[model samples]
Structure formats: C-alpha cells, structure tokens
Target: MTTPGARAEAGTTRFTVRSPRAEAVWLCLFAGEAETRHAMERSGSDWTITLPGDLSGTLYGYRAAGPWAPEEGCWFDPAKLLVDPYAVELDRRFVQSPLLATFGEDTGGIVPRAVVPAPLAPLPPEQPRFARGGLVYELNVRGFTMLHPDVPEALRGTVAALAHPAVLAHLSRLNVTAVELMPIVAWVDERHLPPLGLVNSWGYNPVAMMALDPGLCPGGVAELRRTVEALHAAGIGVVLDLVFNHSGESDVHGGILSLRGLDDAMYARAPEPDGRLINDTGCGNTLDFANPAVRRLAIDTMRHFVTHCGVDGFRFDLAPILARGPGFDPAAPIFAEIGADPLLADRVLIAEPWDIGPGGYQLGAFPPNWLEWNDRFRDDVRRFWKGDGSIGVLATRLAGSTDIFGPQRVGEGCRSINFIAAHDGFTLADMVAYAERHNWANGENNRDGHGENFSWNNGVEGPSNDAAIIAARRRDLKALLGTLFASAGTIMLTAGDEFGRTQQGNNNAYCQDNAIGWVDWNARDLALEEHVIALSAARAGNLRTFAQFPDPVVWQSRDGKAMTVEDWERPGADWLRCSAPGTGFGFTIDRAERSVNIDS
Candidate 1:
C-alpha cells in the first residue's frame, strides 16, 4: 500500500502492483509512439513515476510485466496499457469499444490503453464555516449554469461558470449557506446511453472519487479551485455529492479501467461460494470495506479532496454500503476511522443511508456527527402534502423523525438532511404534476425510477393548461417547501426547484444530459423564486425556533384545535399552522402569549 505522504507532491503520480510471483516490473507512459516507451523503476510492489516534461496535455498509461495465468487470479496482460487507479486526467471517456478485451483472451496478452495526464498542482485550501442552521442548495454543475444566458458562453457547462457573478449573485440573493454540488467526479455513460444517443448524467456512476470530472473543468483543477474560492468569498460552502459505494465498473463483465486493473481484491468481488460479485449497490460491484487496504484507499481519496481540491464536505451516495461487513453494522471501522480523523472530524459528512442489499435501509443508524439523507422525511412530506397518506407520518418527519434518528445524537436539532426531491428522483415540479414516473427518456421504456412516488397530478397528468390544476400544483409546491423549512432539520433544496424546473415528467433523468435536466435561468419564474427566497430567509433568520429541543414548534389545525399525534396520523389534513417563539415570522394563535418575538 502507498503511504499518504508518498504521492502528496505537486506532480507525482503513483501506482501499485501485486505480483509476488514476478521478478521485475516497469511503469510506462503512453502518449503516442514518440513518448510511449518512457519507463520508471519499481521499488517493492509499488511503481513511482514523474513525467519527464510538461504532462498537462500529454496522455499516458502503464504496462506491467508479470507472470501470465488465468486460474491463479494473475492475468498479467502487459500488452494492455492499464489506467492508473490514481489517474487525475483521462484523455477520452470510456466507451464500450471492442478495444476492451476479455481477461481470458491472451492474444499477445495485452489490451489497448487509455492515456492519463499528470495531476495539476494542488490548489490553496479554503476552509468554510457553516452555522448550525442554514439552507443548502443542491445543484448539478452542467444543469445549474449551462442554460443561464447571463453567464459567459465559454464559462457555461464548466466549474468556472458556477463562480460567475450572475451565479454567485443569485445564490447570495437566495440566501443559501452552502451549494451541494452533485457528483462532479469522473463518471461513465451507462451501457444503454450510446444506443439512445444520451449520456449518463446526475454523475452517480463515479469512476474516480478524488479527481474532478475533466468535462466539468476544462481548465482543470485550477478552474475548480477558483470556483471554490469564489463561493467561499460569498460565504457559501461547497459540498460534493460523492458516490463511493460502487464504481462505474459493472459486475464481473464490467470495464477494467482502473481499480480492476490495479487491485480487484480491494473491491467486493462475488463471493466464491457462488463466485458472483456482490451486487449490493444495484449499479455494480459493492466496494469491499472489509479490507483494511480498501478502507485506506477510500480515506486517502477523501483526504485528497480536502488537502488538494479544497472542498468543504461530502454527501456519500448509498452510504449504507460503506458499513456492510458481510452484514450491515453502523459501528463499522470505516465510520470509526473517519470520525476519528482530525482533519475530517469537522468536515460535513452525510450519508444516503441505503443500498439494494439486504438490511440496507439503516436510516438513523449512522453514528453521531454525521447527517443522513432523510428519505422518509421526503416521502412522508410529499405524501401528506399531496393528500395521499396519513399526516401522522408527516408530523413525525416534521418533528425530526426521532423514530429513525435516535434521541441521543449531538446536533442542535435534526441531523436529518431533509428534501422532498433530489437528483436521483423527480424534480419538485414533476412530483406534483405527474402521478406516475415518466422515465421513457431513460431508454428503459419507463421501467426505471421508483414505483411508489407518492405523487399526484391533481386532476391531470403531465402538462396542463387548466388554470386550477396549475394553481394547485404551485400551491402544493409551496406547501412542500413550507413543510421542509418549517420542519426541524437541515434543509436542502434542489437547484432548479426554487423556480420550478421540470424534466417534462421524466422522474429518473440519470441518462438525460440534454436540456431536459438543465435549469432554464432565462425563463425565470419570479413569483416562485420569491417564495423560495422567502422560505430560505425564514429558515436561516429563525434558527432558534427550529433548533428548540423536545418541542420546538406547536401545530394547530385551522379549526382552532391543536393537532395531536392522532391528527397527524389522519390523512386529508391539508394545512396546519405551526407556532414557535423566537421564529423570525410572527404568528397568532388562541393560546396565551400569542406573540413570539423573533428576528429576521
């Protein structure tokens, strides 16, 4: 295993090889025929290489010479120019080309290689300060800024665009404390994308955890750093939505781009009893956190982000998979290691809290100091506001879902990261405008996405010119936002949801990289934006009320009756007025001390 300090230099790149049975090995750089054969000496099981010249635009890969055997788990295909697991820059995106051969094929025992450019110099780190209660704006890089006409054309679709004055000004005006960027790491197009002429988006299929997606930062790390700095200057934190549960590599037949070539043992391969790679992640092989070496690799990847890229925090996708050790255990060593790391202890750590494996839905199981993506809160709120389910579930979720998140956590209020809609599912507009998921665009013939959406079209499906339906949808949207803000928890709003962004009814847009997912800043809905801004201000400006312990706020029905635990369980409760002292907004109720002093 490589030490943390080994590759901490500006331009140094490292690779590890495990050929205990081999005599010698060399690290080769493959840019083109002219510079294809430059070799570096190996020290022990590791090979270290520093480019001879400027490696920014240069393309390179590796060739390891070792014993050739298939059954012994040693398929040394020196002919294949393997990608460095720690590669920072990739020349071309991985496409399912015939160039990728099977492991058994020993035709010259080599495979075509993809060139990886040298790492850019690390950026100066920026540490952000997050107050206890603040609104988080979750956005996708390409989707958020790409269609904004106010931004410069060159800057669009890139990280630099996010720092553009227009973007920053909008975020500042929105009063958001942090911008939760959806997966900016290098990812791969799903196998179905090429045929449908679409691309894997939402960036959930990550190929590298530490490296930024070159597609999002053409100018490279320097550009990304500038963006982070700009956000920090605006008092806005940047948190990356990370997918560490699995790689772009699918199951056994998946691409051998990086990890598979470097070390398959680090990944959770199929158990030999059945010899099928664990498909816990539902995307591909689940990472084997059971291996101490793999755990170190994950930690190293996160450290690179903090020490090099200057990110504020990470929201782990399908985080329950990280704790699975043959079975789910919240006290897993990986969590313990991260919680104890001095550098990472203060950083924001969030978990998606579930995977496809058995017992994967461990919502409140995370240790203290970590926030969890509260899907129950999202679903119950949606259902209640849509008038589909019991308001009791909504009440519990609003009160911080104490049933899920135990009462012993350390956060001021709810450690729940509450949101009605996120990247993986429908946008806010579609949730109230479509009763069922419309995922035909994903090439799965509408078979993809969640079945129990708990959505309502309010008398019409898809687009409706009816004024009443439109008004109802808008009200429902506001109500959902209101519930999210009024509830006790950390609030996260999807980027375009503030202005009612829509995917034309497509709930699962993981494959639509086109305009379907992009936010149309040109067609701004002023009224909707104002509502969102007001709610954000209320949350940020009224921290005390939201932070109150035991009973933060009291809710009462319009009929002057205090809503009980039973009323919350009853369906069809359209609206409830909640009152709390020290809240920025003033309210009047029948009870004594009718006025609650607060600050806005």
Candidate 2:
C-alpha cells in the first residue's frame, strides 16, 4: 500500500491532505522560491492534487478553507499554511508563533518547506530481540554525549555518536539490552520557556512526530539507522519513547504550529461547562482518537520507525491519552489495532499508562501483551527502603506485581518495567541528597514540580561531607538498586542514575537544557557504577526465575514464620525477609537499622 503523505507516483507526483472538516483544500507548491496554488480534488476524507513535474525537490504546504468557529472546533483558515503531518523531512527547522492560530494570518515567510526526500533504500526487517529480565537504559541523545570527554568533539551530542565505540563499550559493560531514548522527534520549546532562557531539554513536546529532530539527528535518519545497527551488533536494541497524546502546540492560546493549524477535530475539545481543549496529557491539549486521521497518524508513525528506522520497540509517553474514548477506554482502537497489527504484534510495546485526565491512572489496564512502567513498584520500593513502610508492598513489586498485572501475570508476557529513577524526576544522587524539590532555578518559584517525592535525606537536606550521612546515603542507594535488580520482569535505569548524577535537588529539570540535566560522567561514583553493573549482570542471569505463575517471592518475619495476613500491610515487626529460593535470592529488610542485606 502507498504511504499517506506526498510521494512520487508514476510519471507525476501526488500531494494529499486529510481535512474532514474542510469545504475546500489547496495544495501550494513552491518552485524556484516562487509559489503556485491549485485547488485539490476531494476523494472522501482525503484531498489530492496530481501535477506533471517531479515535486521531489519542490517545497509544498497545505491550506484548508472551512468554517471559522473556534467554539465548535473548526479553525481552518486558507491564509495560514499547514505542514503535511506525514512529511519525512523538512528543508529547515520549525519555529512556533501564536499568530499561527490567528484567523487570516498569512505565514508565507515562516512556512517550513516539506522536502521531497530521495527514495530510501529498502531497510532490512528487524526481528524482535528485547524481552524480560534485562536492563533498559533511558538516555537523552544530546545531553548524554554533550559533556563526554571520550566521544569525538565533532560527533559529540549527535545521534551518530551513539554508534561510537566509546559509548557502545560503556553501555556493553552495563549489560544494557535496549536504550530507551527520550523523545528525538522534532519538537519545539514550550511557549513560556524562551523568556526564561530555557529550552525543552527533553523532547516530550513534539511538533513533527515522523521527522527526527535535527538537534538529535545531525546526520539525519540514516545516522539513527547506523546507531541502531551498531547497538544490534552489540546485542542492544533501540526503543523510542514517543508522546502521541499531544503536540507542542499548547492550549487555545498556544501556537498553532502543525496539528492544531491543520484540523481542530484532530484534537479533543470539550463542548459545554467550560468549553475548551481537554488537558489529558497535562500539556494543554489531548489528541482526539475519535478522528480516524489521528489514529492513522499514531499507527503510521510507529510503522514508519519500524519500516525505515529499524527501531525494536516503542514506549508510549502518556499512553492512556492515546486510548481515550469518552474516557481512557481499555478497548480503544489504538490498542486493539496495535495488538492485531501484523507489524506491531510481536514488537516490544511499553506504555506510561496514565495521564492527567479522568480515569487516567490505568497502570495495569493495558492489553495482554503490552508491558507497562510500574510506578507502584518504584514508589513502594522507595518507601520500604526509606523505612516508611513494611515488607508487604515491596514483596508484591519484586514478585512481578501479580496484584496489578495479575490473573495471568508475567507468563502472558506482561511484565512490569521496573525502575528506580527516570528522566522526569530527581536523579539517584539527588534522590538521597535532597528531601524536597529544589526547582527555584526553573524560574517557577520552586512551585512547578511534584510535591510528594517519597525520598529521605539521611539527616541532611542537600549534599554533606559528614561521614555518617555519606555512608548512609551510599548504603541506601545500593539497597534501592539492589531491590530493582532483584525484582522480576524488565529493569530500567536512568542514564546517570547508576553513577549517582545529581540535579542540585531540582526534581522538575524539564526546562533546564544545561549541565543540570546532562548526565555528567565526570562526577560519577565509581563504586556505585560498578555496583550497578553487577546488578545488571545478575538480573541478566536470572531471566527464567522471573517468568512464572506462582511467584517465587515468599515473605517471612524475623522469627522464620510465614508472615500472617496482618503482617502484609501493617507491620508490627521491625524486620522481615523477601526471598525467592528458586532464584537463590533473598533480601533481609531491617527496618530497625534501616539497612538491607542480600542473602544468596
């Protein structure tokens, strides 16, 4: 089947745009810097125009004339130009302006030229190589190599640098099976960031879902393919963390860059009782799956990566928003389609299965084959080790979280993606060094981040030179990672967490595109780093013990008696053992001393 966007067809080129709410659609072609506009003929929901010249190098944008009712979700204007949502490459980078949402605002000067790329050589099909009981490293492309002294200066911070032997050798030692990259898709900084001298360091706010961001891909998608090939050679797969719930275009008052300017129904808008765009993604707008075009874009973008880029899997950022129907329906077509899709059926699909909207906390509600990020495991593990809870909750998480993804559990290939820290929150060093979010540097008056972090500071709010505090911090850090490594199912470690990177206590470092967010290898704790490597190796060696029906975890009080029902949640005992004898593993949680001892 022919792909959706503009493509060379026969002797002529065909341009297509999807505008279900338009009265007319125009295809504007730019040749030799001079523009020509032609009315596109309609065929059902798609509008197409065929011309007699090779439009491969020619620049083009679409404009749709439709009803101008912002109240009822129709904001189509012929004066403003729109980018083809399926455009593979662009001549230049994209910039956002609030005037893009204004009616009759001609954006001829700033329209991003959609480049007609040369036909790509057929990519070799990738067989799924990722599975349970391996480490998944979350890395930021630019920040990862930006400060690295080993990576060549010319290739530093570029996608090609990931293929360098220096970086691969480092990852190989960590026993990483897959590198889950933060959003590398073309994204724009948040509207309010420019005035504060900040940029979207993390690529969560995306504009073009298909076009790889130039900041990450200086050598284009080919560099990404080369990096994937390199990782495959090293036995590591690539999993992209994608945000399909919202675009960089913020709220009603935000920029109308691509998706918002193309079609209003493409986004979900509530009708009455404070009529406005739904904020399911907490990013001001939630993409509407009620529109088939939105669903097509989500599915097709994933296929585009698999078909052209050779990605092994995808971790859907704020995934529940992509499955919304009245609310976040478990049986939404997006889930059903991917589950039944020939291309995606066997692929490794992960979900950040929640959003900021109604019924959004759907941790274990995803389909049978889809694995989910286990935040409960994260919180419970931290709380237990922090001496704030009992062995009950921690035992459940370590045993593959049967209560959440239960009834069938890991045997059905649905294992929790366990993690201690990720790109969003405090780093491993900051987690024990700071008790609260120190986001004053974010220019939001330290009021912009999460309130409850579930962290303990070992009697110090920030860094300390005291022998007792430092020793306690290191011990607690080892216990936390030891818990994640001992847990069943897949494991993920944030890029710098293994080495104890800190953000000066800043929990929401999303806006800081500087040293605070970059993974600084220079300030690493060598002992901690080696400790993490050991945990990863041990995790890799226990894959079979991790997948089972009757979970291997058994909870026992210090007296060696099996824990009673009352002991599971409310603990009167100060210490207990969490063990799986089949795996020759167990941990003694000593609440009195606030220490953990692993008994093999």
For all candidates in order, the CA lDDT equals 0.70, 0.80
Q: Give all TM-scores, in the order shown.
A: 0.89, 0.94
Q: What stretches of model 2 exceed 4 Å from their correct place?
A: 1-3, 31-34, 272-275, 408-410, 547-554, 565-574, 591-600
* Tens digit per residue, CA lDDT, model 2, 1-600: 335678774678887777777899888888766878899988777788888866676778888888877777777778887778888766666666666767788886676767665567757776876867778999998888988889988887788888999899999999888999998888877878878888878888887788787667866667888898899999999999998989887887776566665667788878786678988888888888877788889888888888778899999999888888658788888877887787877789999988888888999998877889999998888788776766777777877787999754445643689887888888878888888999998998999987888987989899899999988898888888887777777889988888888888999888877888877879889999998887777656665555442354677987888888877767545677877666576667676675666553
Lowest lDDT block of 10, candidate 2: 543-552
Score candidate 1 by TM-score against the native. Answer: 0.89
lDDT of 1 by residue, 336-428 (tens): 899788667778888888888999888888887788888888888776665565656666776678888866344466688888999878889
Model 1 pairs whose backbones collide = 79-110, 79-111, 80-110, 80-111, 270-276, 270-277, 391-568, 392-568, 392-569
Q: Which has the greatest lDDT?
A: 2
List RMSD in Å for every model shown: 4.3, 2.4
Question: How far out, in Å, is residue 21 in model 1?
Answer: 7.5
What's the distance in Å from true for residue 311, model 2? 0.8
